[model samples]
Target: MNIREGKKEYLDMQIPEELHQRMNDVIKLDRKRRNERKVICMIKRTMASAAACLVIFAAGLNTSAAFAETAAGLPVIGGLARVLTVRSYHASEGDINLDMEVPAIENTSGDAAFTEAVNQEIEKIVNDYTAQAEQEFTAYKEAFFATGGTEEEWNGRQMDILVDYEVKYQKDPVLSLELTAAKGWVAASEERHYYNLDVASGRELTLSDVLGDDWKNIANEEIDRQIKERIAADPSASFFGYGDNELTEAKFTSVSEDTEFYLNAEGDVVIVFPKYEIAPGYMGILEFTIQD
Candidate 1:
């Protein structure tokens, strides 16, 4: 097809605005992370280059990285992991804002059970959070009126409600994904959940698998060492117990067996902590890379 025909067809296609924006985000992300590589229109297959993948697969993509990349690039599919936005719901009602995306994985390396479980959990999370958000907003508005707050004072006020997911790591059959639900109306309520899967085995990736049987001790020692080093290097550098902190109980402790984490491009295990989990909220989310 010529450029004009392609342009006309694109114009004629019916695409949801939210889906379009999401696809744009994916493209931009790909462009940033990936160096110059021949991005072709045709579908192709590429093997996992890392040694870890060999151990896992020869020992997941039951969908390979090449297939995922090619499929994601296509205008219709539009995201990583062949993770299509099966549900995109948005609302702009006054002071009651809602934005959500429910993704469905296609041709996953994980078995049918794994895929089904992931999808059900994600859908439930999104649905439950959305319902809670709406309730919270309604309750807040009622309380405001009862407390003598005028309509004019609350007329222009608004709060965001969002439920979304992102694939943090997707190498062949091993995928690290996260789901997040947040509201800004009051108390900054936000919750995040992570899924690190060995898609081939249909089993969740554990710290033990990533860092061996002594994963907890290794992670704790390395984290504390890193924190102390940072504090020693710069006094101003603040981490909960290492530096200035108001919350005495929020100190960096040994990583839990089910701690949220992901694999970096180099196949290194990067531990993740949500905001205010181990430090103040100003520090936002924190990550620690387990050194070899």
Candidate 2:
């Protein structure tokens, strides 16, 4: 895609007055922080690159203005108050590169303490993942050397760890944020983290909020039905529990309150499964819609 053209389209798209004001505020705050510290500027630049990717994708999609704005990583005000990328980090070393986008909230209906607590939680998660990635890279390098692999050969075995976010659904009183972390090397795998927030109360939603007490049985049954149907329609399609010799009934049988999910543009609940969670890595990230 032509990134320049996509950025132009994003800039030309109309934005709500309140949203524009919020963006201005964020920009001003960012500038002030940068002026205060060079390190802060570097952090902001990394975040801008990731946010730019989202804006480019949203522009290419050419969806509604509201959809595009939210998808562009602009802080969504109201309901969940505001959700935006606060920091980003990227590093390349040896045969691996790590990219991460961290999110934060502001002006939440929740008390200041609550907002601070949430921010801390997000920071901790990001830091932990980054440190883990670094350790993994070190281990890989050591193992490669032990195997009599030359530096050139090790460099050729490129690997990557990426973390990014998407705004799946946004409407008054409800906003869904989906964070995905993927690692690519000898094999590919992904893990999804979802946050469904109730804006008015600034509370992160659980499955019970939308699916009620019997949500597990409901979700599992629907997932099982869909898996079977998909496999039937495409013989090559494979799932963890369903194959020529595998246990067919061993498919998804339960869902936790924290199960990854979000609403599609069509307003249907979509359950997300990471790579190899329910199917082969070739499937990448698998999603199944639970129709109302």
Candidate 3:
């Protein structure tokens, strides 16, 4: 896909109507499965990104299978070009169900050692989440039975955990990956992990890599200003401790190189705060775009 002026042109060509319809069907199927399983939250952003890749590949298949396969094998701009589901886990009992998609990287172009390091990191993250989910589910099951809840009742209580990843930015030399893990019953809790890499050197990029030495001061100031502006503009806008509290001060003033962030489609730096990290769970995931 060719991205021009912040818009993806999908190779600057038209996709056939039949292929477009098939892509739509795939998206619809994904939604249906999510609904049927009653997963807490949907990773819409990552799903959309995945859908686009599928569409692009599907369009290529229409021309020639060989060409399509070649294009699919092409390396992404910076390093990792292909994101595929390496593993999936699913379990459904009376009231509980768990589903997860583990993403893996392929066709990486970089120093062999560095590329392996990045891949290993991705695998470790996914495995950690999978382990946690399994542990939680097992505990829940034990507790349900101990509380006199019948097996049928246990089967009826529904919970879901999903994992997905998106290519946030893929410009030359810099590549950003956004990994999402979302879970919930009535409401969902979501967390995002960002990996920014300098492909040439096989080094992970921190906030300081993108911003300069004064990054802390600049980022904290911008975040504080935006937070105050949001609260002023809308009374409903709320954070954990906004007024006069050390907690609020600590949260707002502690911007560091390790802060979680990624470049959006518009190439804006976006700072992410997991649910309840800075505000109520109802606020979902909190994000602020650092103005350039």
Candidate 4:
């Protein structure tokens, strides 16, 4: 599970020592599943990008022989004029449940084919992830009973799966979308995907586009300053290795071209960090808004 912002704060788990130790095994298994999911998503995205290129190229060569028209209409990357919850799943089966809102991009402006490809990929991801989560929950439940967990103790062990999205920015040609997936029972983990669409241009937006060539230095300095300011504002919140905080295996460094980011409504570039990426999991997901 990936932690995210603007979600329910994780509750302090009051698990019994014996049960906690047993659940640790389940948690470890879930970690494995998460890793596998990541690999699958990376491959899916690669395939989607390749497919998009082919689709666009085919359209350009066969449909629009006019180079100027093709270049102007078909974005180099897939984009959307609007986003809507095209599908949803909400059901409960005893202690198991599914709650998701599948988002799809609709580009009436032009290039519906690439947008369709992206939607198909998103749908596949949600379906695959949901199937895996169902299997994991069933296994965990069976194991609990096998390991002598009582009925009363297992009463509230529900697998509430959730998937949702938000539009971070939507101003004419530039649109930013954020998708979040997480398990309600496992608030300690989360996953997020950000999409920045530029209808005016074919290329994806980068930090250099927004912050010029000195993006890394500017971003690093801003993040460091914000981290300190946030910690000062809330004494309980802490980012790993920023000050007197204990060193962790992963620490905040400079932003890269591949770093996760989005454009907010204010047109500010918001840099996003996954939970535990640069801070303790308890802090949830960290975000730094770079303002001029």
The number of the candidate with the highest TM-score is 1
Model 2: per-residue Cα lDDT over 230-250, one tens digit each? 889998888877766274464
- The segments of candidate 1 whose C-alpha lies over 4 angstroms from its true place after superposition are 1-81, 108-110, 178-180, 243-250
Q: List the residue pairs that clash in candidate 4.
A: 1-189, 1-190, 2-189, 2-190, 3-189, 3-190, 76-202
- Candidate 4 wrong stretches, greater than 4 Å: 1-80, 186-188, 199-203
The 10 consecutive residues of candidate 1 with the worst lDDT sum are 36-45
Error in Å for residue 115 of model 2: 4.1
Better of 1 and 3 by lDDT: 1
In candidate 4 the C-alpha lDDT for residue 209 amounts to 70
Please give each candidate's TM-score. Answer: 0.67, 0.62, 0.65, 0.66
Model 4, 110-164: lDDT tens per residue?
A: 4556566667878887777777778778888899899999999987878777777
Please provide, for model 1 over 82-177, each residue's C-alpha lDDT reduced to its tens digit, 9 standing for 90 to 100: 566778889877777877766665533325476567678777877887788778888988899999999898776776776666655454434444
Model 3: per-residue Cα lDDT over 1-292, one tens digit each: 4456545455667777899899999877655433331111111122233444455546656777775565566566422344566777787754456566766555333343755566687678666765676667667777878989897775555666666665655554344555666555533334455666544344565777556688787788888888888888978777767754236543555676666777666666778776667777556567889877
Indicate the TM-score of model 4. 0.66
TM-score of 3: 0.65
Clashing residue pairs, candidate 1? 62-109
